[model samples]
Target: MNYQLSLTVAICFGLLVLLGYFLPDFDLLILLRAEILRWAAILSGVAMFVGIISLLKVHFNKFMDQKSNWGYSLVLVLTFLITFGAGVFSFIFPQAEGLVDFMFRYVQVPVESTLAALLAVLLLVAGMRMVRYRRDWTTWLFLAISLIMLIGLVTIEAPIPDVFPFLRDWLLTVPVVAGARGILIGLALGAIITGLRIFTGADQPYGE
Candidate 1:
């Protein structure tokens, strides 16, 4: 019975998806496409909720055992609960409460910014150490680019000749932006393919 139901649903979905592409003249196909997208969003939200539940469970266990770094888990749980409560109350009240917004703006933002700054420092230190150890052309190139980027971002005015700021702008706009965009596109495509594969029963992670 389960097999038959699954097969039927798959067949129907495939036919509707194909129809939307093949018969671009039909308005009903467009509606079907929208419906498909709506359901996809709903399912994705549910999946995200499931993931959060799993993460909370793991962290709660760690906290209960008083594991090393359990303080971080405590912070995580506290933050999650506070944010959840704020969201629920915000929904009920419909007015932006000062305390909730303050917590979100001051507490959350500073913590996030501090963490980001720490990571950036760690990355820079690691890169410097690598350059010290390897002293290869690749490491040299990485250090050069990183330093140029840091300088460009920090300096109010370009240190180089007027033409050099233009050059730096070009390098940042062209290569840096293009590489970042390409990586993002590749990651998004990979995620979509993996999701579809799982949905189609081609990749099973649950050992079914």
Candidate 2:
């Protein structure tokens, strides 16, 4: 009974959203869509809060169980608490916004950038190993493109005029852009089909 009610609501809301998007000139639908989106935003915030509580519970359990790598779980909990406390403090006292900004700019950004740099190095190493072992045209082509992009970066920054910058721009503008558009179109079609399936009761991700 509950599953049927939920499925009915899902189909109704999904169709309403699709109608709102495709029929922008309908005044009533536009208003309904706005209200639905506002409710969605509130629900999304509540979901995030629930997710945080779930995360904390899992980590706390791990820390208490003395399992392998439990020390890392403890560290995670401590970091989460500190960050949450800082955010609360900023909310209560507006003067602490600078501290929050500093933490985001220095701590968060650097950590993210460091991870990205490590990933790039790992990919480069993997590409080199693949080319060495595979001896395939595809592998060689991939490696060659990677090398060209790297060289383009270096040349663009150098103190000499070169065609690398133009070549990089052309590659990005033509092949990259075209490929990205194709991927996006495919994804949009897939999402539409999935939504249609759910709406028609052909797919019930929640339950039977």
Candidate 3:
């Protein structure tokens, strides 16, 4: 009974949202849809806050238990609290704007850039290993594509009418776009199927 009620509510809201999008001339439907969306956003924010609390509780428990590598959890909690406090202070104080900018520019950006550089180096190493050990046509093709893309990106400042730029543009516009669109279509179809399963009670994600 409870499951049926939940499924009915989900299906009704889903259909209403779809109808609102397709038949925009209905003022009442549009107004109701807007109200539903507003509530959805509020609920999403609440869910996020709940998730953060749950995460902090789990980590705090681990720290209290003195589990192996619990120091990392302690550090995570400290950093999370510090960042949150900093954000709140910055919001409340006009003078703290500089502190926010300094944290983002000096601390966050450099950390992110370092991680990205490390990832690029790891990818290159993996590609080299694949070429050296596998020696298969597919491995060679993957390595070739990676090298071409890297070269194209690095040589972007080369004079116009250059081969690297031309190849880069072609690869980006054709193969990359086609692959991305195919992945997006697959994801959309999967979501639709999952939604249908829930609507029909074929998949009872909520519980038995």
In angstroms, the error of model 3 at 105 is 5.2
Candidate 2 lDDT tens digits, 103-197: 88999999999998899789878877887799978887777777677777783356634676677778889998999999999999999898789
Q: How do these models rank on TM-score, best leading?
A: 2, 3, 1
User: On a 0 to 1 TM-score scale, where does candidate 3 land against the true structure?
Assistant: 0.76
Error at 72, model 1, angstroms: 2.4
Error of 1 at 61 (Å): 1.4
lDDT of 1 by residue, 1-208 (tens): 6665665566577678768988989999978977987897999999999999999998999999999999999988988998889878877887766658888789879988999889978987898799779987988887777666656566665455554456678888998899999999999999989867756766545531
Candidates sorted on lDDT, descending: 2, 3, 1
* lDDT of candidate 3 over 1-208, digit per residue (tens): 8888887887888788878988999998899899899999999999999999999999999999999999999997998888888888989997886776788899889999999889978987887787778987888777677767777788336554467667888999999999999999999999999988877667778852
TM-score against truth, every candidate: 0.66, 0.81, 0.76
Clashing pairs in 1: none
User: Model 3, 70: alpha-carbon shift in Å?
Assistant: 1.1
